[model samples]
Target: MTEFEHMLVNSFNTYIEENGIRAISYRLKQHRFTPQFLDVLVDSLNPDLYLGIECKSISVDKGANALYFSQHFTVDKNGIHQIERISNYLNKSGRRGFLAVELRLGTGHGREAYMIPWNELKKKYFDKDLKLTLQEIRSFPEIKREGKNYRVDPMEWERK
Candidate 1:
């Protein structure tokens, strides 16, 4: 992981602890072959609150207000969607699939994070297999970004 990615993950870990949430994050290296696996797994006493997160990070242009998430597909492969496949798995397993989006500022001063649920994302925003914008994601706030930081709240989960 790059230094920024490392910083995001570490900050997320600290957020998890401060919130008293039971969660664990797996490195991509361990699950590269299994694209259906999530980057982070969050479990709760209330089964309905479980979450599967796919962490994604990108640095936008200066003063950029929005970012996009393109559905994972390889041009070389006929039909392979690593990211969407993971989302499908999490949804089918009775866990909410989420994108842990990290927005890095162009100046490298700070970063913003948001957790967007997959159901809302895929159903309304995703155009076929293209991209979803940050504006659509910001509508729902499982974790809200404040001055480049987001504090995750388990209580904000959308009860399925």
Candidate 2:
């Protein structure tokens, strides 16, 4: 697991425990020769509130405002997708699918994290170039670290 993934998982689990919510977020482990389509699974007391997350990260220079998400398929195999399988399963009715992307701004500059909805990700799959620029990513919901944790949980999650 990447450090960024760890950060999100840690933050979410901490949120669950700290708030005394009846929920649990855990990373799915991969078995031998088996691929784990998603990275995180969040189960809540509310059946409709289940969440699935796929973690991805990229590193860019300090002053750069644009980076690219691996997204050129049929033309190349270097895209950031699981053949749309993850999106297909998690994006169905009543399910929550999310992308936890961390943009590392080199060393000492820290990192910028964003939680993008699956609908947003699916929209990019139809782009002519099939790529997402960092400028576009910044427009999504940005996540920041607070103290030892990052706030990655939804407010309604605490209501339970």
Candidate 3:
């Protein structure tokens, strides 16, 4: 995982801890299909919630408050494939999958995040560039990013 990815995981774990939830995050070293490897995995106790989080970062020099969801592959692997892998793992494990994206603006001083659920993501509902505005994501109270932490609202999370 890159430094940004590591930071994202840390932020998420911190949020979980601060919320009085027993959750821990671990980063997967290997990116594979089977056996289910992901960028970050959050294991929660008490209520028994498991989340598979995938991290992606974009530089917004133009101050665009949007997240660019990529599906095509050039140098790196296709993001959709990765998302599917995580989604499959979540399905098999009876958990939920989320995508955590970081957008850094001018001078890297401004930063925003969007946490999109697998169901909303798989629809390919975004524009031609697969971009979602920050405001659009904020409307979903259940799934949203607070600072660098991509998290599900505790109120919206179902108890098991």
- How many backbone clashes does every candidate have? 0, 0, 0
Per-residue alpha-carbon lDDT of candidate 1 for residues 28-136, written as tens digits (9 for 90 to 100): 5554454437666656555645667777766655544554443332322446455556656876888877766666666656666666777765654445534656665
lDDT of each: 0.58, 0.69, 0.60
lDDT of 3 by residue, 1-160 (tens): 7765776677667677788777887787774553435577878754344777666666667655666554321122443444456556777876676666666666747556566666676565432436566676554433455564455453453322
Off by over 4 Å in 2: 62-83, 91-94, 127-129, 155-160
> If candidate 3 were superposed on the true structure by all CA atoms, what would the RMSD be?
5.2
Residue 152 lDDT (model 3): 46
Better of 2 and 3 by TM-score: 2
Worst 10 residues of 2 by lDDT: 67-76
**What is candidate 1's TM-score against the reference?**
0.66
Per-candidate TM equals 0.66, 0.79, 0.64
Can you give the lDDT of residue 34 in candidate 1?
Answer: 41
Model 1 clashing residue pairs (backbone): none
Q: Which ten residues in a row have the lowest lDDT in candidate 3?
A: 71-80
lDDT of 2 by residue, 27-46 (tens): 88778666676788888866
